[model samples]
Target: MIDFWLAAGLLLLVALSFLLIPVLRSRRAQLEEDRTALNVALYQERVAELQTQQEEGVLDAAQMDAGRAEAARELLADTEGVAAPRVTRLGKPAPLLAAILVPVLGLGLYLHFGASDKVELTREFSQAPKSMEEMTQRLERAVAAQPDSAEALYFLGRTYMTQDRPADAAKIFERTVNLAGRQPELLGQWAQAQYFADGKKWSDKVQALTDEALKADPKEVTSLGLLGIAAFEAERYQDAIDYWNRLLEQLPADDKSRIALQGGITRATEKLVASGGQVVKAPVAKATALLKVSVDLAPDLKAKVQPGDSVFIFARATNGPPAPLAAKRLTVADLPATVELSDADAMMPQLKLSNFPEVQLVARISRAGKPTAGEWIGRSQPLASSTTAPQTLTIDSPDK
Candidate 1:
């Protein structure tokens, strides 16, 4: 922003100087024209006076001629015309003095008061407004200026969203939908605004519109993701999985859509398992340490999964799961259910508590149970050593 402003100001100053040059030149030329005209008139008048005097016999022809010549010479001297010596402004002191002083004055002023850091033009325009009234006025004016303008309406809807007036935003977006005719891209944009602005009440409507958008362009990742979200909200887990999984294929190799798709999978699977699953009692021990595992699933996700697959928690045979240790699962209400992995009991599954102080733990899972993705979480000791306790990570809920 600063660089842009500096360049702009320099260009403006140069342009203004160019524009001023013609006006100054005209003033100088006008000064010369006036002086030339005055000298010509004076010379003519002096010649006429000399002639009149000679005609009246007050002086001889030679005397009159000499007088006329003298007058002409005097006039020429006064006007610096014929036989005038050259005057050198290049050697003048005042102008040189002014040149030095002008720069010094400019430098002083700039150092004292004008070296601004603020890039003061439309930079302010880029900052979002805090007040809704100003936003409303601007939005209204923009929409009014171009009645059938899809972009204008879209801007207005965004403004409304920023102002927390989703209902109003919905109205504007509906209008935008109407204005955007059959242009699929524009229509998709309108539908997107409408979907978000409608908030979850019109889920079915959003679904229909987004479907239409996808039909127009199957590669619309944004609409596909939204459709997945809507489906999840509506409790259609399989359909949500389909939408997000399809969306994942359309995403760039390194994108969050794939992660989102995986997360959705984890969530659905967890819910289904928790709803009804058999639990074998694993005994607890006298000495125990908490294991928190950091799992990175699907580094480059090609498909979306929701909780139909099992996630196996494993630790390094010598260092826990590569990096992260194991911790308890977080409930949706920000509650952590106690999960103890080791104790001094025989029934407890081959758990060694005294093994690795540097627990390199990982959470591994699979897409279609083909292979597991276990991401490294650093040692639990640092988190355990912090002055402030780490918050429990809530899992698998949209609001969370």
Candidate 2:
């Protein structure tokens, strides 16, 4: 900040030179005009004395003429090479006043509108932060300096969440979403923070956020993990297991979190079995054949769609490429429809649904007939490809 001020001051001096230099030059010109006038006055006095002496017969005409000529020559020599004074329409006071106000007004305008605070923030961030608290403070300051910056707000919100200040984190995340749009990762973060901020209680708003996030990208890890935590807190062991399992599928094989998450899934499964819930052990992937799924548009979104819109039902490997392994297409009019996905429907011989251990079922309504992107979407939790139960997937959220 001090360096910034110093640079500003130096620029101000440069600007002042433009105004003050002219004023100083004008003063010098005025002094030259005065000096010229003084020399002319002395010449006139000497001429008057010579003429008086000639008229009184104390000097001859030639002598007087010679004296007058010499005096005229001296006056010409003294005034030689002096410039004609420049005319200033605004007068001396105006330029002097401008010289004083230029720096002052410039500073006032810069303070009100310039990006000095942002410059300071950039400088501060260049250095490594000493602690989490220091980093959080820097992020907060950055957000303050650039209120419309979605990236700054995102980092600040994440820092708040890490500090256990979920209420503040939730608000910051909300602002970020407003600026950056309803991106899946941001929505998932907002949902997680809002859930914790509300004392870990589930609400329709949080549910809606998580649903929208997962619909846009079914493998959204944050939403999956948050849902698992919420289900566990509500004592819905089976739900906890399903959500955790979905989240686990998104993790890498070497991720350290996978061990902890697997432990969580095991605990949830044990609780479910203890509470008289049926636990089915899925068969090996090579033995899996067909998966029957029921896809439907949500009632609230029914009016927002057209009957001719294409509904794409697909199964994708949880840990493989984004391309669907097996797919089926239908019109919106045929929704509330049942579909079967199997190795026979695979886009390629080597990408069969049975080849993957777990798959996510997606039902998307694309008005443009593109299967990869759509207006509305629904997704199922990661499930074994061998599961024979009819899966239900609802198109209840915006595609992104």
lDDT of each: 0.54, 0.90
Per-model TM-score versus the true fold: 0.36, 0.67
Residue 132 deviation, candidate 1, in Å? Answer: 13
Runs of candidate 2 exceeding 4 Å displacement: 272-278, 282-400
lDDT of 2 by residue, 129-219 (tens): 9999999989989988889999999999999998999999999999999999999999999999999899989999999999999999887
| Total clashing pairs for each candidate | 27, 0
**RMSD of each candidate relative to the true structure:** 19.4, 13.3
Q: Over the stretch 1-109, how does candidate 1's per-residue lDDT look in tens digits? A: 6686577567656655654555555556667667767887988898888889888988898998898889788776766743323354543454445555655675578
Question: RMSD (Cα, Å) of candidate 1?
Answer: 19.4
What is the model-wide C-alpha lDDT for candidate 1? 0.54
Candidate of highest lDDT? 2
